[model samples]
Target: MKIAVMGAGALGGYFGGRLAAAGQEVTLIARGAHLAAIRERGLKILSPRGNLHVPAIPATDDPATVGPVDVIMFMVKNYDVESGARAIAPMLGPETMVVTCQNGVSAHERLGAIIGAGRVVPGVARIPADVPEPGVINHSAMWDTLVFGEADGQVTARVEGFRDAIVAAGATAVLPGNILHDLWRKFVSQATLASMTALTRLDLGPLRTNPDSRALFTAAMEETERVGRVAVPDLPGELVRKEWEILETLPDTMHASMLDDLNAGKRLEVDYLSGDVVRLGRKHGVPTPIHEVFLAALRPFKDGDPAGLAKDAVQEFRTRT
Candidate 1:
């Protein structure tokens, strides 16, 4: 299969590199020093499963450079969904499939609005990886899985073929009975972890170990489940408990990507994670006080700390004078 990995940071780099190693014709779309490093020294994957170095993977910053592809792995940050979709428009063919492996639930719909819904496939990424430096991906966890399916829940040939390609690349891939439900399940846990970790400025070990923090985490997840049930009525009522169970199984050092962004002084995805929960809660008439606090506290850092802090400092000096 010919695949294009749009936004070749962390998640995209690791998975796309693995697929290329498995004999798929893969091209990575990236920018800045990372793109330059990939072009010069190739992409490197350091993982507990195994270390891989694809010395000559094709990579470029512009999607137009690599014409139409069989599959486009749309893995940009949640905020970049619309622009990324527009950027990749020139690479879409009649039979091309664009699979979104983003955090929030609205990515597929946002992409579907630009490109046709038929061309978009909803997917969930279960790997914990990060780009420690340019062109180098550090995969921490052992479980690497990609679960995706058609928007209409059909077991189509394209879906099956993509699953085969992913599995052959040595990653777990599956077509769930209901892809929307799976997305919601992922959101329930992700929003909870991202909110608590970012707000408290701690990792899962500290958050899950303390009784008060754990209760807050549980409440946030419960609120997300309440909103999810109204938005997706078919969602199981026991989803909150199931998510808590999954949370307990995670390694103590685990933390959400939003926390990583916060530590790096980069823009936060709180709007899409916890903020999405707050938005849906309003739409469904569900109360989400916990998530509301999460959004309010994190909104200042949503666009990163630069503009907001500079503006605040100027205002303070003027007021004192």
Candidate 2:
């Protein structure tokens, strides 16, 4: 199948490169120096499992120049959500499937507004990946497991085709019966960790090891899980506990992509993740003091000193709660 990766950053590069390596017709939409590098030297993937340099893959910055493809892995950053979606809309054919491998709860809906709901698939990616350098993706420590499903929870040919393609690309695919539930479950797990690590300026390895920090992390997780439950009532209550325990088992140095964005001075996903928690809380009349506070603290860094922003956020969270 012809697959076009919209972002081509760490997440897109890792997954798209894998597909390209497996002989799929993959095109990476990129810009500036990264686009140049990929065009000149091929797409380079430095994964924990291995490494590769895709020599003949197509890389471009303009989506209009590229024709419609069978699938599009929409992996753009949170900041470029709409713009990216808009840019890729013209490239989608009637039968094209656009998979959103992004953070936040309503990504599928948000993109659906621009690309039509029938062609949208909500996806949740579980991996630590980022572009350590332009044209180079560093696949960090985590299983390259992906879960996605059709918007209406109906298993369709497009969904199954995506599953087969992903598996052929050498990653795990979770074809959940209910994609929304699966996506929300991952959001609960990721939102808690991203906020805690970015705020504390510590990796999960150290943060989970500290008594006070661990407690705070758990509290945040508990609060987020509470918010998620109210937002998604169908989610079982005990699932949060399992999510927490599973997170505890990951490598301590594990930092959410938000933390990486914080350190790099790039825009963070606080608004969609924890910030969404606060928004939903207000909508449901649920008290979300923790999430609200974290949003306030992280706002300063989301723009400029996001690294220091996270530090201050943690300190303030520690002091207040």
Candidate 3:
């Protein structure tokens, strides 16, 4: 299958490199040092499952250069959904499937608005992976799964083919009957984890081990689930507990991508993750104090502190006092 991986960061590089190694025609869209590194040394995937180094792979920054493709693996940060969707117009063939493996729920709708619902496939990526540096993808977790399906819940030939392609590349793939529920299930845990870890500046071990922090985590998850149930009416009441159980099974060192962004002083996806929960809660008349606090506290750092302007401001204020 011909695939175009839009945004060749951790998720895109790892999965796209695998597909390319499997002999599928893949073009990775990336920019700056990452793109330069891939073009020079190829994309590298480091994982416990196996390490893969595709010494030579097609990569470019412009989607139009790739032309049309059978599928587009959209893995940009949540905030880049609309711009990413619009940027990939040249890659959208009539039957091209654009699947988003992102952190939030609204990406599919946002992509569908630009590229049409038929071309947008709702997907969830279950992998703890990141680009520790340009051209190198670090898959820290043993689990690598991609779940997706049509918006209307039909098991179409296109989705099945894409699933098979992903599985053939040695990654787990599923075409669930209801992708929205799966998305919300992921969001429940993701929002809580991202907000808690980013705000506290701690990993999952300390966050889950401490009694006070654990209670805060549970409360945040419950509030997100409450808002989710209203947004997705069929979402089960037991989803909160189910998410908590899943969280327990993860490695203690695991942390959300938002925390990674925060630590690296990069822009965060909080507006789309925790901030989404707050927005939906307001729409449905659900109270989300936990999420509200998370958003408010993290808002200043959403776009990062490149020059330490925030730090400088704090220092100046301290001197004034």
Candidate 4:
């Protein structure tokens, strides 16, 4: 299958490179030094499963050049959903599947509004990957899976075909009966970790262990669940509890990707994760005080801290005191 990865950062690059290595025609859409490095030396995946180097996969910044493909992996950040959706228009064939692979549940809808709902496939990616440097993906965990399906809950041929391609590329691909519920289930845990970890500036190990932080974490999950139940009406009442149970099993070193972005002074997806919960809560008459606090506190850093002004102000205040 001809595949185009719209945001070929860690997540997109890892999967795209693997598919390319497996003999699928995959093109990476990226920019800056990362794109340059991929053009010069191809993409590299430093994974625990095994190291891989796809020496010559097509990499470019323009989708018009790649043209239409069998599938488009929409892996851009949550903030870039609309712009990215518009950008991928040149690559959408009549039956091309545009898989939404960002955090947050609303990406598919936003993309659908721009690119037609019929072609949008809701996806939930479970992987620990990051671009430590140009063209290099640092995979920190062993859990690597991609769960996706039609929004209508039908197991269509296209969905199965994509799953087969992913498995052939050496990664797990799950086709859940209810992708919406699966997406919300992931959001419950993801938003909780993203807020708690970034706000505390700690990893999951320390955050989940502290009694106060643990309580806050549980409450945040509850807030997200309340909103989620309304979003996906069939969402199970025990979902939050089950999600927390799974959280306990994750590696202590694990943390939300937002924390990584926070430490680097890069953009955070708080607007999509916690902020999405706040919006949904308001619409559903659910009180989400915890998520509201997270949204307010992280709003300033949503774009990024390129000049370190926030940090500088805190330092100056400390010195004056």
Candidate 3 has its poorest 10 consecutive residues by lDDT at 309-318
- TM-scores, in order shown? 0.95, 0.92, 0.95, 0.95
Candidate 2: which pairs clash? 205-252, 301-306
* lDDT tens digits by residue: candidate 4, 78-167: 999999998999999999999888898999999999999999999999898889899999887777899999999999999999999999
RMSD of 1: 4.4
- lDDT (Cα, tens digit) per residue for candidate 3, span 77-109: 888988998999999888898988788788899
- Model 1, C-alpha of 247: deviation from truth (Å): 1.1
- The TM-score, computed over Cα atoms with residue i paired to residue i, of candidate 1 is 0.95
Off by over 4 Å in 3: 306-321
Deviating ranges (above 4 Å) for candidate 4: 310-321
Give lDDT tens digits, candidate 1, residues 1-321. 999999999989988999999999999999999999999999999999899999999999999999999999999999899899999998999899999999978889989999989999999998889999999999987888889999889999999999999889987899999999999998988998998887776789989989998888888888899999999998876888887788888989899988778766788888899899999999999999999999999898888866556346545866998
**What lDDT, from 0 to 1, does candidate 4 have?**
0.90
Q: Whole-model Cα lDDT per candidate? A: 0.91, 0.82, 0.89, 0.90
Clashes of 1: 0
Q: After superposition, how far is residue 83 of candidate 3 from its true place, in Å?
A: 1.2
Which residue pairs show collisions in model 3? none
Which window of ten consecutive residues has the lowest lDDT sum in model 2?
306-315
Which whole-number lDDT from 0 to 100 does residue 251 have in model 1? Answer: 89
